[model samples]
Target: MIAKGTPFVASYSGGKDSTLALWRAVRAGGKPLALLTMLDETGGRSRSHGILPAVLDAQAAALGLPRISGQASWGDYERVFVEQLGRARAMGAVAAVFGDIDLAAHRQWEEQVCAQASLAPVLPLWGEDRLALVREFVDAGFAARIVVIRRDLMADDYLGRVLDHALIERMLADGIDPCGEAGEFHTLVTGGPLFAKPLALADGDVRADGDYLSLDFGLAASI
Candidate 1:
């Protein structure tokens, strides 16, 4: 468990795993100082999920946390992330929390970067059973929707669908990972126990990038 009452920076991706990690951290009495996100080179969308800045802001607002985002290309991602972590450290953050479940290389990088920034690395979901983790998130009342999927692995119809038992069963029947850990899919969480209110989203255009088909999502003006 994280040291209670200690301020920590969350490696937020606006996805189910990160959301669950944040939720767990809060429940364990960790104080979230900021939500750190990596943006594309233009700083318009997230690096992995393609969520807009406004959309991420809404998510941060819902969770009542500050959003700290940085823009960088693939070549400079590590440097940019470490720079942000340094800023967070200066802001009194002693640890960095991540949502990675079982990626050894990813965890190593997270630890290395945190060490460089003078912060300890914390991974709440490390080594947990993937399928059980999905059930835990859903049962804990966290709501999320699919936002991207591998075109070769799933149909476009899978996009924008809620992550729930039915979807889990379907994915299982289709022989796909429930958590989509193998790059099978990605999701955007809209509501959950950690949120003060739900985010309003609208479906935008669908575009194909590499092996993935992404469903662009826009935030509603009400936010």
Candidate 2:
């Protein structure tokens, strides 16, 4: 773990969870030097949440911090991610923060990657009640939109919808994880307490790839 007040890097996906984790970390007095995003092989979108680089750049700008990214396909994902952490280490990050909650495998992988990069793995939401965490996010008034959904797991109509308490309750009633931790869906945070200014995004095309449906979110997101 990082010493109190020391700077660290966050494994940011530009999603609700990651954004919340970083915000909480800052609130606890930790200094953040940068946000590290792993990008797909094309270097266009984030690997985890499929957020465009331009939008994430806007997020970084809003937070007034630098954004660092590593690009790779599945074959080289680990190597590239470790390299990004290496950069984080060089930037004086003693620990790396992630947003995972209650997923053992995800924690394990995070630990392994942090180990390889000589940094500690920190999960602020680890082992917390999932529903309570979702409530916390909603109460915080952070606005996020469901950008990608696994059509087999959830209805395609859920795409591009704003995430809120009512929708989360519906998800729970449908036996879906409120946080969509099981690959059911993913989101992009548009505005939050941590943002100096809200992202001005336009909804874009809705496209299907395999069993997944994604919204480009009006492709030209900027500050």
Candidate 3:
């Protein structure tokens, strides 16, 4: 458990859930110690969403928080991820936050990783109704844009689109998980309650690769 004023880092993927998790931590009075991300070795992008590292840094700046990131090859994901958390722990972080909802495997992985670093794993939105949670996140004023989509599950049209109630409804109507828990989609948050200032972003073109669609975008904020 994290006592008040103890440092807590959020394992941010620039995704909606992780954004919400960070917001919850702030709401609970925890310091926004740092944003931890795993950058892909192919390029300095987030492994989960292919978002540029510079863009993520801009987002972090908008939130008035520092970032800790490291590059990792495809084969080194798990090891590198835990290593980043270990670094945060060594820096005096006592708790780590994750945005997982109800996936047992994910929860187990989070628990194991945090345990290895002697940091408590905090899941503020765990086990909640998916639809409700989606609604709640938007209602709470978080702004997120779809940054990646699994081509087989989602059309390229969704790339770079803002995640809103209408989008959620459309996803549900298409038999897709509104929250994209089944790998249907991934998001990048640009604005929210936790942010000291909203991120300024401009959407770019979308590219389709072998099973994934990547949305190109740029984030900028005054430092």
Candidate 4:
């Protein structure tokens, strides 16, 4: 149970896949101890989807968990991530959870890193149907919005669009992976069963990030 990892620290990306993975892990008796994210060397944005630190903080607050993060360049992403895993392990995490569905390379890398940190690797969504995984997240009451898209693989118009049934179906019809596992798109989860409350997000301008286009967002003004 729990893929042999309890009291795990989820490798969170502030995205739906990771959120769903965390949910399923808890359902399977995993003890979620903390969230871990990798930030760019600049220390301003998350490397996975360009998510801001504030967004991640809001997510952690909503989930009632602490976060462990490290800033690193692509050249040292693995080292930094391993160090972060070490930090989580030192905090009593026996394993690290991931959201990889069907990507062999991704899983391999995750496993390697967990091994380096002496932590078990948990993959709750591993081998699940891609389309069904997306549906599961939506049907389970989780809400997310597209926050980044690869310019070569997807249209920029998808930025800021919520991951609803319609959008998923359209992506499938267009030959895009609904799960976006191959990096076609990335999302920021706003609300879900795992959260104490939904996050309020205010849209901002889209900025180009090399081969990807990222949308900026912030916590909405509290009324």
lDDT values, one for every candidate: 0.92, 0.88, 0.85, 0.91
**Models sorted by TM-score, best on top:** 1, 4, 2, 3
Q: TM-score for every candidate vs. truth?
A: 0.97, 0.95, 0.93, 0.95
TM-score of 3: 0.93
Order of the predicted models by lDDT, top scorer first: 1, 4, 2, 3
**lDDT tens digits, residue span 181-207, model 1:** 999999999998979998889888898
Candidate 2 residue runs with Cα over 4 Å from true position: 1-3, 218-223
Q: Over the stretch 1-223, how does candidate 3's per-residue lDDT look in tens digits?
A: 2356768989999889998888887777787678998888865678888888778988888888889987888788778888888888888888999999999999998999889888899998899999998899999999988988998998778888889999998888889898889988899888888677777887766778899888888753422
lDDT of 4: 0.91
The candidate that wins on TM-score is 1
Structure candidate 3, residue pairs in collision: none
Candidate 3 wrongly placed segments (more than 4 Å):
1-3, 220-223
> Considering lDDT, which of the candidate structures 3 and 4 is the better prediction for this target?
4
lDDT preference between candidates 1 and 2, better one: 1
Q: Is candidate 1 or candidate 4 better by TM-score?
A: 1
- TM-score preference between candidates 1 and 3, better one: 1
lDDT of 1: 0.92
lDDT of 1 at 109: 98
